[model samples]
Target chain A: MADKVLIYSRFPKTMMTRFAEAFELLDTAGKPAHEVFPAEELAGVRAVLTAGGTPLGGAEMDRFPKLGAIVCYGTGYDGVDLKAAAARNIAVGHSPGANAASVADIAMTLMLAATRRILVADQYVRSGDWAASRQSPMMRPQAGMPSRRIGVYGMGEIGRKIAARCAAFESEVGYFSRSRHDLPYQYFPTLEAMADWCSVLMVAVRASAETNHVVNADILKRVGADGFIVNISRGSVIDEAALVAALTDGTIAGAGLDVYAREPHVPDALTALPNVVLSPHIGGHTLDSHVAMQNCVLANLTALFDGKPLPHDVRPEGKTA
Target chain B: MADKVLIYSRFPKTMMTRFAEAFELLDTAGKPAHEVFPAEELAGVRAVLTAGGTPLGGAEMDRFPKLGAIVCYGTGYDGVDLKAAAARNIAVGHSPGANAASVADIAMTLMLAATRRILVADQYVRSGDWAASRQSPMMRPQAGMPSRRIGVYGMGEIGRKIAARCAAFESEVGYFSRSRHDLPYQYFPTLEAMADWCSVLMVAVRASAETNHVVNADILKRVGADGFIVNISRGSVIDEAALVAALTDGTIAGAGLDVYAREPHVPDALTALPNVVLSPHIGGHTLDSHVAMQNCVLANLTALFDGKPLPHDVRPEGKTA
Candidate 1:
């Protein structure tokens, strides 16, 4: 029999074609993989391709008795049960750093859109308000990027890219990361210190159990009434409830958010607030990123079937399995 | 008599207070100087402070017989009749390069907004479409700033700033201007050739009779189906009707416009198109630019009154009068 593989994520037609050439494709996109396929149909499944939203726990892995590897479709693999996979001696692979540039671009997009109030300006021009009034409403004056201080919460690849872009606009760039790199930018040891020093605070940390709700009320308070915050990292990295309160009480000036605590479900309070710019989690939804990630998934799967080391294996905590 | 000055534009209270200390202020804001002010009121007007929109011609100058200078509020003085001012020996002063950074900021804002489809994304999230659909609408994939060619139409102060910012995003920057500069960017002698070579074409040329309708149907045709155009310069620099048709057909991908041919009157046809992002001539409407321009205006007026050479004098074409 042909080596069978289960696909638990939606992919473009081209990527599906590539998968078909290598294995017998069993698609369970937009549904729970365990529930979608019968026991007999999943019996010979040796590997699975999943997206970030699909939870692959011990229970799901138990279904595929011959399962050898699980490849995540995107850079983020938070939903994948790494500990469970490690215990089962099954390899876990993910496309790491594939969408860094795209996510950084979205971070800048949200920053500019929120600060410049582009949505409000577009509405003013489109609704005949500009024509009727013949004058732009006197809005709070926007401070441009030049000479302003920007504090990045995480200084990984994405954060570094964001800082580089901000620096080109003549912004003073600073960062807060767990350990300092050899970068020229000033490194703040704590999040609150970075918030206090910068006018615009950007969150770009990775999401893990330890990092959950890292940016809470205290950090927002330190950012204060004149500062802006932009979040392009995982939604769990920030305390959404604290953010809502900050925006409501004017503890911070404004925010640009791409991720939410709940997938596809944003709080009504955030939508109602005028001080926030919201976009569906689309930071890595570019064509270039998608193709790169697809290639990564293919590479991981090829390496696994050939009985070679996975190109992007995920480790449990501080140790590699 | 205190040196009488006619304020032909609406200025901030602070600017007006400063003007009051230097002249007998004749505030003609929101009213035509020739029609609203009688002969008696305009007789002793020794100078006029106006914006780019307020035309200062020989006829308006005739009302202010003692007018020694006309100080323009913003950088562009297209509305002011330079030849007429030269003929009447009325010195003209304007704030050159005052809003270059701000305008360049807006140019990048539009380019990113259009390419990323930010307005549509904002609408998608705000309307709860993401919650209902659970997936973003699979539109054409966005190719980001990195590895893209950006063609700047004019390489003045604003264009240079824009090029520097694009470079930071890893875009290959090119320019088309009447003459060459010492910059390292590739120079395209013709606009059509630049359009063909670039994915994003930014129009930043100053509007004059010679440069009116510079980006017409021919240029848009060369920009083709996958390209975007950004205009932070004067509206008349583009042929609006041609742009409307190109956007309707698939001749060009999209546009980010901050100006229109008619003040406060955006065409209904242009408004109906989903491909364009529009703002009401607010490229330089920032607090920083405003204060800088105000200081420039003040300096020019002070110099003229104190019998010093005009700091930012506008000489007539090919003649210094």
Candidate 2:
């Protein structure tokens, strides 16, 4: 008999096909598992597969006394309630750095799109502005990437990839992380110091309660009126209200955002601005990243079924945000 | 006394302020010099400063008997009639490689934008489609940058920079140029072979009469339905009609174009498609690139007036394109 694994989050049925082949899936379909499955079925569930963002606390974990593992679909596992999982001795697993390259690719994409004003240029040609010989301040020449300073807020897998790409463009790279790693980029003691020094502040920091709204009015101001902010990490890292104000009043030149304070519902004030290049939260949404992450999930689940430690278990201190 | 430099093309007065300070003012404002100025003034013209695309043939050159030099503002001097300049013993100068980095940056921008479907994702967020959980085939995962084959169609300054950036992303790099250079990337003997081998074909070949429409329907077909075409070189290099058909019929996946076959007047057919990310020939239009190009122009003009060789002169064999 296949080991029963509860699908705790809502995903398109297609994404669940692989897990269904290996295990008996009791899909809650984004509802409370107890509501979908009776007490007898819940007691037999040995594991849970979920999106990293969905909140799974101690109360939920207790529903399945035999639950030995929790496997996150992507790199992030912020809402897993690490303490609760630890107290109940649930081995947590995640696909670390599986989506880093894709996330970094979007970071570069957003940075170039915002800094080069490609979106504005696109409209300029489309709206007959260029043909009419119409002039706008927006068409003014922009500085190139060479020798520009790029400050990364975090120095994890995604940040390192971003830094490497910046370096290849001949831009100076700097970063501020929890602790300085022995990397080629210059280390800053604080995000403010790095923000002041670099013209393009790239937020790749892992999000936490402590990091909520870390990139506020002060950081935006420090980035200077000519600077830009590119955030690919998480939405809560920035104070969206402050970002809106900064963009409105020219505290910063532009922004390229993938994440938002509220998922799927970005404030209208942001969408109204021309300087921003906004994208839905799909940073790690790539074919290769998905396959890699799925492999990790499968590996973790197989290990748990075999009574072995997860090959890609998340450490308590290094929980993915 | 200031040297006489007849401004041959239309430019806003602000852009001419710097040139006006160094040269005797005879602003034609894009009109023919003979129409704007008397024969006596035209005879005294020592140099001509014009855009590289405006036609400057033997007939035009014959009017300026005293013209010592033809200096191009930006790269591509295709309109200068290089043969005519050589026949007249005129020194031709341009800002060689001054904007290579910027052009390469745009190539990367277009590649990422088109491949990752950033614009689609942006629309998804802005239109509340994401909130409604709308489904799109485009929202399907994309392959990450790592190990992806990137074939550069030209191995010039711009192509070299693009290859280096792609390498940093851990992408496999290949190229096909007229003459092979000592580079780390794999070189193909022909464009077709490279196009078939690479998933992303970056068009950076210099535009010339012989190279016009080099990337035709056949080339587009070889790029395959899953591949992309990024052209930052010149509009003349690709068959715009074939490109339109290919894009419409899904002969190729997508394209990122900076230049079109016609200036400022793109066919409505091309603009109607959602697969392309279009820009109006703004590849080298950056503040830093402009400043660098201007310095080269200044050096070329000053050298001509001082009875010295043009420092940034275009050799007969190495005309800017």
- TM-scores for chain B, listed for all candidates: 0.93, 0.95
Pick by TM-score: which candidate is best? 2
Q: Compose the digit string of candidate 2's lDDT tens values, residues A1-321.
A: 569999998877888888889999999988999988899899998999998878899999999999999999888777798889989899889999999999999999999999988888888887888888889789888878984789999988999999999998878899999898999999999998999999999999888778999999999999998899999988889999999999999999999999998887899899888899998878988888888888999999999999999998877456532
Q: Tell me the tens digit of each residue's lDDT in model 1 across B88-144.
A: 888888888888888888888888888888888877888898888645543446787
> Which portions of model 2 show Cα errors greater than 4 Å?
A316-321, B316-321
What would the per-residue lDDT of candidate 2 be over residues B12-94, giving only the tens digit for each residue? 68777777777786889889899989998899998999888778999999999998999988778877898888899888888
All models: lDDT? Answer: 0.84, 0.89
Steric collisions counted per model: 0, 1
Best by lDDT: 2
DockQ of each: 0.70, 0.76
Report per-prediction Cα RMSD to one decimal. Answer: 2.4, 2.0
